[model samples]
Target: MGIVVDLNGKREPQPSLEALTRLVAADLKAVNELIVRRMHSPVALIPQLAGHIVAAGGKRLRPVLTLAASRLCGYTGTRHIALAACVEFIHTATLLHDDVVDRSELRRGLASANAVWGNKTSVLVGDFLFARSFELMVEDGSLEVLAILSRASSVIAEGEVAQLVTANDTETGETAYMDVIKAKTAQLFAAACQIGAIVADRPAVEKEALESYGMNLGIAFQLIDDVLDYSAKQAKLGKTVGDDFREGKITLPVILAFRRGSEAERAFWRRTLEDLDQKETDFDKAVGLMGRYQSLEDTIERARHYGAIARDALGIFADGAEKDALIELIDFSIHRAY
Candidate 1:
């Protein structure tokens, strides 16, 4: 997210943690400003759709993590800005394509770029953003960074395809679900942090630790996201609840509930998947079944476990405020409201 930490050398209310977060804040803002400026394009339509999606806004968490990882690795250079922007561009492009694939009307509390610009324009602009991201990466001129990010992109695409194929299948279990989340979410998180260390010339051990941290954090983040889709309020959630079900996308909580549910609950799921326009009562019935199955609590515990694993990996780093901040980030992902 556009980090709002104060970088000034002022006495802050939060005491010892302020200064550490402030350093991250300065670096985060610089990276964000650079990405915004570099997002311009000569082709009016391309820039138009790209700008709409970029300005639609997100937490910018991936790029922020990249910058934070660079600072944590003791990198003292401006190149991290371009690299951060590259991560964000790749992320945004994926969101654009995703909205089209999901046929989503809303994102980040606003109209999705595809909803506003049409799928054809949205897809083309997304491709343009992807190409532009590669150009930025090439400018950084690190084969290590290139290799890490390119492979992540490939894996994420594969995950998207796999998820699409398995979307409405009740047979999809935890193993299949984990594969989808790891590819779709964790790949980028791992690459963002790993490449940050790579660009900073950190040792392999530290780099691997950061990659492990990112992967677990990503899994926890996406699992929580899926949980919230079924459990959160509509206004607070920004999107409709039961979206995964409505879209025929089987996520972790639903899968868990279906696996543990009664025969009647299974029949309800069949109807929901086969008929997208199932009654509101059916949605309530499914929600109640999920509760009956304790799927929500199970999902939360799973997310908490992954967050713990992520924090444990962070411990491999030498003691520093950055390491503590990383730990706080894992906690935040587990406890976040939105």
Candidate 2:
């Protein structure tokens, strides 16, 4: 049985991305080869730094979505392979830039590119990857693909800027946070999935369905990520628990906790997050407060809601392994925090 009994004696489904990865293994391999080839540069540091993060054990989820979505649409051509590589380059570029912006030392349990090769190098390499992604798009000769990816790129930048504006502000509401993640994270996901249909020359309805599925899944994924930041499981996932809290990131957990707490608890949040006067013990206390208010649980509940929508969005597709794997992906996305 792929089910586990937790401490609460509840049956939990253990879902993995293996099904999707196996289904698209050949295309994924081609995408990987293309990535390696494109990442090469005469400048030694570009490849060195870019390859470091690219090979840092990070699950290529975005590109995998591209492959799976394309397959789901019955696309038999070689177009998706390069497009998948392009999606990965965009995602990888974001990770490099994010690490620099967050001043992060660790990425996927390894030293971050910025931490290893300075911020300037990381940013430049990120730019190089972005350029490579656009090059791939242009080479594909699809104006629609180019437009979708370029728009996603711009939206992702805007989302990053929005998050920066909201960071350290405890008063950042759920609506604002949703906007940030949707723009920053979900937009790329939407573009990736939608491109699959576009390449397949599917109808607008199928394209819209995929876009909806990707957007909802992206939101749920980010929500779980927020929950994981305060979870013990975070270390296992290669991130330091409470990095978000330490950086004064106003995630959903913190937002819920702050909104639901008493005056004293709100004051603690203000002092720690807004004032940035955190004590060493504050992280544990923050987690305790989140537990007290059931903020983490509620956040997971929110993810489930989005996951449901994502699953439903796929209802228009035929019943098959591709659809099953995509649906299970929603389960994996929501349950990974456990």
Candidate 3:
């Protein structure tokens, strides 16, 4: 939906995070500086390993949400900057642990911390990041913010455990998959947004609205990520296509494909995903099955549904550049597959 073509057959520019990034540019710079300063440590490896992942360069969407949300709610204070850094720390910690759990070698096209340093160091650095996040939260000196972020941290851990239970299980349903992503991914988004309203001393209604927007946007974001795992375009973008398939991670695409396939196809899924007895050709075969079942397309459609909800949730906010950028972010999140 984001793509457009003129009579000349050239694809027009699609929706992007540029607007949001530009809107929060200065605050983002502050957050980045704070992150670099806080990640420092006397233990040489701590900074080294942490710096590696930090330098790997992601979109920093979670922290951006914090910055944008605070501005949207008319906050003029500097508190959001440190809090945004806190959110980034939480996200970076999760990525470190996730790469270790998945035995991944790459992150944002660079060697993952775990791949370079071993699982022990990666995990310890992740713990350090988590500790740093909590320290930032405490320094903010808001019990409500503390409660929100602490709850998100616990929910994220629960989501990871839930995903582990559902992993490699072809019988996992769509509902269960949604639950895992909402917790592991969306909980922090919600917290990041809600705290912005809190810091601004906005009303409860505004807080709830922003929370809902972040939650739904996060779900849409993860759904597309799952679809990207099977997309050829993902490889060009530096992500390893079919990582989910190789890891036996039962994402929405796999769940839908397995549910719709014939009995023979189901057995194929069990062999590749459940039993983890995969040959090199299995990834192609799996992608073919997903194509046959229209699973990838349907997953995109599912993402659109959540994106719609996220857009609507922003209805409470007044029209401004912050709101506009945030709304565009929903489109960017869903249409990034292109």
Candidate 4:
């Protein structure tokens, strides 16, 4: 809520991804090794295509969640390493599928997997990753872990399909949008964090606590992504600015702006977004309207609410560097848009 100076730079006192990396450095390294090891295949193109996306340098937050939460619960075993890798594979598979669904050309500052390789290849590789992830889960030999992850997988798919169904219609309510994101995005985060407790043989109360943290954090993360789509410069944000607009995606910002605008403004949105009749200046006009209505700021503010919840969910853990970093990570999710 303080003054946002550089729309490109992070807010002051934001959680450093590097700091979190350092906290989980050794486990992360082992997870990365396991990721590479499990990705190998007799089929030449499988590893070739999957490696391209893996090498693209995503933040790896999902896997880090697994590693960090396990350590937070004082788990010291090596099983968490492979399980962390499984989390990454699930995330990577979703990204591959999302790019194809979104028809995105660029991914994480480079060509999307579907862009460089064909859609068929991208999808098959995604499937392969999913299968590989299950292999690791089964190898871990915990039916509870498998049940949690597989349920997450199904919920994620349902979330995507729900979003797809809601795609261009301007009548989508806040409740509907919340449901879609909770399923599509927050479910994975919840599952990822909860698995850390499972591996630690922690009690259900601790598992639910981690799940709450991850779920709210994921909600905050996606809400910021919605804010950044309109507020960030294309080069800095990586994905093209106004992509959601172009794709006729109904994000929170657009939803707020649409609902708050005048009849003419609503008509304009319907013409461009609902009717797929965007002009070059339409994007700027949309931004102007959103700014006038304070939609972006409002969206960021909502993100901060969920972030606060994510932080409070960690109250059960005693104070330590791990707990501190996790709290900061929540701040990082909301403040990254600054």
Give TM per candidate: 0.91, 0.97, 0.97, 0.95
Comparing 2 and 4 by lDDT, which wins? 2
How well does model 1 score by local distance difference test?
0.82
Tens-digit per-residue lDDT, 1-338, candidate 3: 24679899999868988889999999999999999999999999999999999998889999999999999999999999999999999999999999999999999888899999999999999999999999999999999999999999999999999999998899999999999999999999999999889999999999999999999999999999999999998987778788899899999999999999999999999998989999989999999998999999999999999999999999988999999899999989988776
Q: Is candidate 1 or candidate 2 better by lDDT?
A: 2
User: In model 4, which residue pairs have backbone atoms overlapping below 3 Å?
Assistant: none
RMSD to native, candidate 4: 2.9
lDDT tens per residue, model 4, 72-148: 99998888899889999999999999999999988878888899988989998999999999999999999999999
Q: Write the per-residue lDDT of candidate 2 for residues 1-338, one digit (tens) a residue.
A: 16778999999768988898899998899999999999999999889888898888777899899999999999999999999899999999999999999999989888899888899989999999999999999999999999999999999999999999999999999999999999989998899899899999999999999999999999999999999999999888877888899889999999999999999999999999988899999999999999999999999999999999999999999999999999999999998888
Which residue segments of model 1 deviate by more than 4 Å?
1-21
Q: What TM-score does candidate 1 get on C-alpha atoms?
A: 0.91
Q: State the RMSD for candidate 2.
A: 1.6
Residue 329 CA displacement from its true place in model 3, Å: 0.3
Q: List clashing residue pairs in candidate 3.
A: none
RMSD to true structure for each model, in Å: 5.0, 1.6, 1.5, 2.9
Instruction: Decide which is better by TM-score, 1 or 4.
Output: 4
Clash count per candidate: 1, 0, 0, 0
